[model samples]
Target: MASPRDPSKRTPEIESWMNGADKLERLLDRDKFKAWGFVIYRCTYRSDSEWEEFIVRIHKRVEEYLGYYNGLDLVGSFAPTVLEDRSFEGATVISLREKFNEWAVTAIKEEQGIDPSHLWHLKNGRYRFFIMVDQEALDSVLSTPEDDIHEGFVRLVNAEWKPEELDEEELAERGGPGPEEEPLEGCTEEDVGWMKVCWGHSQMPGYLQLDGSFDWDMYYSRPPVIQSLS
Candidate 1:
């Protein structure tokens, strides 16, 4: 098994998306565009056929990249169930997302011996990925002090998104925000720690809270690159 901290195990798109999403979270200051410093790019294919096609390509591509069993054990484990039914509507998206998140936790714990309850889990929207963290799980560990948890939690999610990265350490060290600095308009001091606090529940509502709605016209209708093996 690759080290629980293997960077090679993560796909490039996921890594790219994570970096972009983390920056967005800090800019937006609400943790609105990310789940654990990463963005889950969702397929917004308009038709059931399009959705199927996208999934098939990902299956082939991911399997080829990570080996058949390896891919199946990761996101592939949840892909079949979502693919079995060709509809990627609101209710279906919610259901599969919840299951995928749960299963990822179990998978990570089994494969790497790391507790995913603290790290963020990615959602594989056959068409569209969500920048959603396991909010309920995060809340459950509010008191998960930085020192007590494994350093791998941050790296496991994304090296760019640890508590130290998001917290006020730099500002504290430098004295504070700039002279003209002001807190985000309506947000509070605690609100700034949106990523750090325990909201006590998965604020993940229906499709809308997380922009959970499906807009089929918006998907990038292309195929993931499939590698050819000798």
Candidate 2:
């Protein structure tokens, strides 16, 4: 069996995933964009068709926002009987760009083990991602102390967003936003960590949060290209 972290298993799929992350990292390092981040949409669908529909709709919605986005990446899983309880996840990376570029489709999965230092695991089968772009929001969140738990981060990550109001009858019947609009919850401060947000840096490699436990590597060496970002 191929160990999850084995670097020798460099399949095309794995290479694609690495390239995706690297591309995003390079974009961030350029410091050309004002702000960039990702949003985690924790949703479930009744059928594969429904999931496909949602993906198509979202892809279109993202296109409509081209005036405001430089590039975006959509990734996650689709399953029948998707539930709000916990079984599926998805995220959209929106890099508010000054110039437009072709959007990339690259997905991350637990099996990839892309980052050997920190393994990705589905904790309690649930987690959330937050995209804080507002200047004030960025300042507040990025201010979180290194060792301190980020209550602000948790609150924002698990926060629910209500849609434009509907008629009383429509609202009551639909029970408010459907499964796709459900708010993320049950995540605590202990379940999250801010990754690569170094002090005094404006644009740096950023992740939603460290998704899993660590595999501390004392002698690990980053490639020369990656080290240049420091």
Candidate 3:
């Protein structure tokens, strides 16, 4: 499979960001690619610095998996916008609460068909971020069946939305079929089929925890833009 774009080959815009140490700007050149979707999330009760740490960790984790999957790119920002208050709080909380309520009610109705509580207790913290994912990669992962996907690849695409552990042991145990119970007709012991047995874990990106409410806009098609960051 083709590798990710080399940093050495980055465009002039990326070069500028690098020169200025604008990490997010360097990774997310929205004007150059169509967004497959957008994500908004907040951090669990913690300091702003902690939230930034989460962003860095998540970025590194995603980078590791990029080689395992194609068509994926990401860029994120924590800057406050008009929708967000000075503390970077209002917008994300409102949207997450709204979306969570809708989801909870729908789930409850599907199971018991009853009115569900619309309240979502806000967690303590003021860290919020917005991410835009390129369309080609997001669509490919979303349309594929879960059973047919590589665990590591799936984890990369959903890193922010559903933060999952990408451990090799967590993947279904793989091995040749168990020993045959009976011999085929006219087959002797010498005719028994032989199969190789393989074992052990493959390295996987580590786990991450955002620990806050969030929402996904899988159909976002506009050119990537985080107004505040811009």
Candidate 4:
């Protein structure tokens, strides 16, 4: 057998970029990735264009090279959010964790750094961050393969009526049902009709918190729109 190699050969410089322990994904426990099916990337960028470019490029990379296995999508979180003239001010976002492909994310980051004249080198720690999910909430949703789907549907149908209205109707149908009986407890009747429109609608609960991240500025600015993927 060959002699064992010395640990001295492992350079933090090479490992930092290649292995990307400097990358937040390296710091994450592997189970986090497997469980969540995604990760959050929180970073700061100086210019509005930098933010735009990062979002566009990440979307491009996923569309061109990634697939369902990655389950990748993005949100521009906390944008138009800036400190008073900090060198870099960027938003956080959620997407496929780097475990899906080290190079997919690292390559985009590296490419951005290749032409330093265009931008300043940013410390991943100073700029990038991770947002841990509510393990309990995530577990509740994902562990049980079923969703509150029927609950959501019932909510949609009875949104116009008061809670007591549904209760009264049910009691009349069931002949003055006992007070202990409760239908759809812990859930309210509301506008859940959108839930039936798409599978994503069911997942809205997990993602609803991300509504704050929606780039309303994109609509106001009116960038050229794409009618179709083709």
TM-score winner: 1
Which residue segments of model 4 deviate by more than 4 Å? 1-38, 41-131, 146-230
Q: Write model 4 residue lDDT over 78-164, tens digit each, in one string.
A: 121112223112311111122213422443245333333321222221112122222222233233323232211100011111233
Compared with the true structure, the alpha-carbon lDDT of candidate 4 equals 0.25
Better TM-score candidate (1, 3): 1
Cα distance off (Å), candidate 2, residue 27: 5.6
Query: lDDT tens digits, residues 132-155, model 1?
Result: 223232222333442222111100
For residues 61-133, could you state the per-residue lDDT of candidate 3 as single tens digits? Answer: 3444432332133323221111212343333323444453454445434432333442122121111222211
TM-score of each: 0.25, 0.23, 0.23, 0.18
lDDT of 2 by residue, 137-195 (tens): 23333355433222112112221111245688997898864444222232122222222
Better of 2 and 4 by TM-score: 2
Report every candidate's CA lDDT.
0.29, 0.28, 0.27, 0.25
Candidate 4 has a TM-score of 0.18
Show where candidate 1 strays beyond 4 Å: 1-45, 63-102, 108-170, 178-230
Consecutive 10-residue window with the lowest summed lDDT within model 4 = 151-160
Residue pairs in candidate 3 whose N, alpha carbon or C atoms collide under 3 angstroms: 71-137
lDDT of 2 at 89: 27
Q: Give the clash count for model 1.
A: 8
